[model samples]
Target: MTIERFILFSITAISLASLFYIPKEKYRQALVSFLIFQAFTWPGTILLVQFGKIEFPVREFTQATQVGFTTNYLFYPMIFVWFVIMYPSKACLTKRFLHYFIFVSFSVWFINFTTIYTALENPLAGTLFSQTTRSYITFFAYYYISHGFIVWFSKKSNLSIGG
Candidate 1:
């Protein structure tokens, strides 16, 4: 298989396996995260592609679009659940800030790197800066929104993050 296919399939498998570990109560947050992630990523990617911000080599009737959507199906829920579960509630501000910084920084870089290596040859038409900016924005938005929803839902439902 091509590296693209391998990466996608590996993420798919790992994602499926990860689901088994999620507490039943937390499924709601995962679902919400997945939906919101799609809400952002699907259209955002299409606009980027159409506007020449990015390109996918695949050209079979929106298969390229499917790449964006499907890969997200794997990653977003896992990330949402993980962040909620690992939230350091009692940590000092410095530690919490470092956690957010590390995850966001790494996530942005890995996500952009993966996009360039697997889905696109490169960001297109002088869109490297724009695409990079958009990526950081989207990912940070995802992180905050995902975490916020989990916190909110947990409060409303009278549940803990893992319970």
Candidate 2:
């Protein structure tokens, strides 16, 4: 298979395997986080694509949607599951900020690398700095919103955050 296809398959496999790492007690949190994150990702991806801010040239569901199904619907939500499950809720503000920064940076880099390998052009910005800046903003927004929702849901459902 081609490298792009191989990379996609590797990501899917890794994400699936990661799900098994979640503790049994946290299964409910994982499920809720995954679904709630998808609620944001689905429309967010569509808008990005629809507005010409991004493109997924090599992706599943090409006939059905412009978004990358694996990334938006599966990979990202899975990552968010871990993000919520492993959040440093009681950590110092600096540590918490670091946690967010680490995840955001990794996410932006992942998308940039994948898009470069799988597409003919950069999807978001012209220069590397500009691309990284835009990606950071986009991903930080998604992370912030989804994290907030997860926190709110946990409280409403009587689930312990980061337990």
Candidate 3:
């Protein structure tokens, strides 16, 4: 496999493996969050790609392939699952704001940088710093809204596995 594919595959593997470590009782909650996040992000991604804002290349910076679909559909959702789980249960407003800022900023930077480093380019590729910064802001908005829903849903119900 090409290096790009290899990297995507490796990440997917690691993400999948990480899922096994979450506590069994918490798995259902995490899974619910994962699915809910995917429900929104998946279609949001499609719209971005369709609008020429985001691009997903295959082995190279040419055609795209669904082979690495798990990178988004699986890997990200899994990561967010853990992110929600790790959130401070009793955090104050400032702490929560700081945590979300740091987490979202780093996450967005990592994703955008990795995409470019891996030869993928988005519509804002010309202004590297600005593009990434804007994307970070935009993604964090989505993250907050979706993650908030997950948190709310989890707390509002006693829904767990087999419930």
| C-alpha root-mean-square deviation, each candidate | 4.9, 4.2, 4.1
Q: Give the residue spans of candidate 2 off by over 4 A.
A: 120-125, 156-163
- The prediction achieving the highest lDDT against the true structure is 2
lDDT tens readout by residue for model 1, 1-117:
787767767767877888888788867766776666566666666777687766666422463353454455456556555666667969999987677666666656766777566
TM-score for candidate 3, please give it: 0.80
The Cα local distance difference test for each model comes to 0.65, 0.81, 0.70
Q: Which ten residues in a row have the lowest lDDT in candidate 2?
A: 116-125
Residue 13 lDDT in model 2?
A: 97
**What does candidate 2's lDDT look like per residue over 106-128, in tens digits?**
87888778766666124763666
Give the lDDT ranking, best first. 2, 3, 1
Across 60-108, the per-residue lDDT of candidate 3 in tens digits comes to: 3234542236655776677678777878769898987777777677657
Clashes of each: 0, 0, 0
- Number of the top TM-score candidate: 2
Which regions in candidate 1 have their CA more than 4 angstroms from the true location? 59-67, 119-121, 127-133, 157-163
